[model samples]
Target: MRETGLLSLEAKKRHARTKIHGYYEGAFKFTRPVRLDDDCLSVYLIHVGGGYVDGDTYGSTITLGEGAELAVTSQASTKVYKTPSKPVEQHTKIHLGADSVLEYFLDPLILYEGARFIQNTTIEMEPDAVFFYSDIITPGWSKDGVNFRYDWVRNKLKVYQNGKLVLFDHLLLEPDDELEGVLQLEGHTHVGSFVLFHPEASREFAEWLYENVFESFPDVRLGISDMEGGGIVIRILGDRTQTIERILSHIHTFARRELLDKGEISWRKY
Candidate 1:
């Protein structure tokens, strides 16, 4: 059976406080918006089955009104169970109004042996809006203790601002007979990426992030580059999931404090 989920969010300012309005969800569930601060709203996405199965399909849409601030995340890692016949699919779309802020950060995706999964995410924002997004992929345990057991994984991400395409990222990994010679994983079991798009983004921010990472995490390999529309693009590869997760958390925390001038966000689920 195919399962579908939908969500929408809007924010309005009332008496000097940002209040969330026009919120909706179906199939996929979320807890009531937790006010991290007077300006920030946090919501966590929940999966009904606890994991994705064969023939499962899910979609979510989010919109932020002008000057609204919202962050969307998942309660736990997305688990992709074995699916020998069919692949599970997920799609997400997000829209941001002028001066709005959005942060879409989620836990890693764990793929079991013989699992197949596809995901697509698109974001459209006004020229002055601020956005941050990230995700990770890690190989799950297998009985044979062999690496790269997943059949295939594909992910695509696109971002647009002021009706102009600003960034496009695509990733595909399929282990087969020639997997040994390929550099897909580069002898690593986990891979991750993060992106930040805002008017304040500059080369100095990217440089600072790149330099700071080397001092703390020497084992993880990281690459940082500038996006077309004044933001930072980061690619990370590591052997341990915890190492990558920690690195991402550090970056996200820094961005929130420096860019938004907000304090650390605490989630009860974690």
Candidate 2:
């Protein structure tokens, strides 16, 4: 069966007064940021915006309005597994208008042994708008060489604002690459990341995320970097899925409170 999900955020100001717009509208323009529609089951978003199995695939899209600011997140952990037939695939697209801002707090994608999946995200931003995005991929879970085998998980990320290229990142994990190789996973199983944007972006915020978010966890390797549009990206690698999810949640909430002036808008497990 073919299945699809959509989330969108758009806003318009009434002479400088901001008002919420639609739950999901088709091609509209606005001045203030309005949370159009949020996909409640698997993904979470305050102002704006999947699933499983063998021989099946799912996709989603999120669009932002000009001058609107919004954040998107996943409600629960994303599980990617391998089956005898076909591997799972997920596709995401983000469109930002001029002066718009977006942040995504994606929970870790747990890849099971023998599982093969491909994930990609494309971000198109306006010239004056700020955009920040990231994705982290890790090797499959394995114990003995003869029992469990995982390989060939591909991930790609691209950012373009005002038609200008900002960031392009690609990663591929294979079973033969000396899992212990330098500059790779470094013996970590779980991987995650955080992307943020806005004018308040600074070196101070990056340092704060490292000390306050990553430093609190033990046995986790983390790093923070800058984006082209006054934003920051954080990467973390660990063995436990729960710990990695916790860090992602914290960073999501922190950015919402600090940048968007919004409170913690949570998701319910249904």
Candidate 3:
């Protein structure tokens, strides 16, 4: 069976405030949006499955109308079990209108032994819109007690601004082919990535990360660079999930202040 979710949001500029004008929810649901200053809204994504299984296919699309501001997060980590017949697939597309903003921070993703997974993401936004997105990938326990037990996982991302392709990133990990080489995971088990796109993204932001955020996490390996069109890409590798999570969390907090001129986002789970 195929599981799909659709979310469409529009902003209404009436009554001297910006709020959710209209929205539609499909298979995937969301908790009530927590309001914030300056027309910001935060919500948690909800799914009704224990985890993804073999031959499972899931797709979702999120659209933000002009001037809308929204933040989305997953309540819990995602788990992908063994996929013997067909690999589990996930696809997401996001659209941001002019002067809009979206912050999407999904919890860690776990892939068990013998699991096969594939993911594709596409983001289209206007020149003035901003997006802060991040994700972490972790290895699940295996009966053989061998690291890198999962079969394979491939992740691909494409970002477009003003209807023009600017960035394309692809990551393919094959453990059986010896991933400890220089260009591969390099003896790391957990991997995470943070992407920030804004018109003001520059080399200075990358320098700030090196001096402020990256130095705090001495154990994790990180790389930050500026995108061609205008944005930043950060890749992190660590042994523990918490270590990577902490590094990304710090970046998110600092970036929000500098990039969006907003305070910390309240992410209370309870």
What TM-score, computed on C-alpha atoms, does each candidate reach?
0.92, 0.71, 0.91
Off by over 4 Å in 2: 1-55, 83-87, 127-148
| CA-lDDT, candidates in order | 0.81, 0.59, 0.81
Q: Write the per-residue lDDT of candidate 1 for residues 4-54, one digit (tens) a residue.
A: 555565665556556665544445777778876666778888876668877
| Candidate 3 residue-wise lDDT, 195-270, digit = tens | 9998888888778876787478765688888976568999998888888888898999888888888788768876
Clashes of each: 0, 13, 0
RMSD of each: 2.1, 6.3, 2.2
> How high a TM-score does candidate 1 get?
0.92
Instruction: Residues 1-270, candidate 2: write the lDDT tens digits.
Output: 553333344443334333344443321112233243341112253212133446545455666666755544555556566655777666667777777666565556656676777778888876666554545454445566332265467777777756777767676766664764568767666567666666677788777767776556655688788765666777777766667767777776677677666566564334
Q: What is candidate 3's local distance difference test score?
A: 0.81
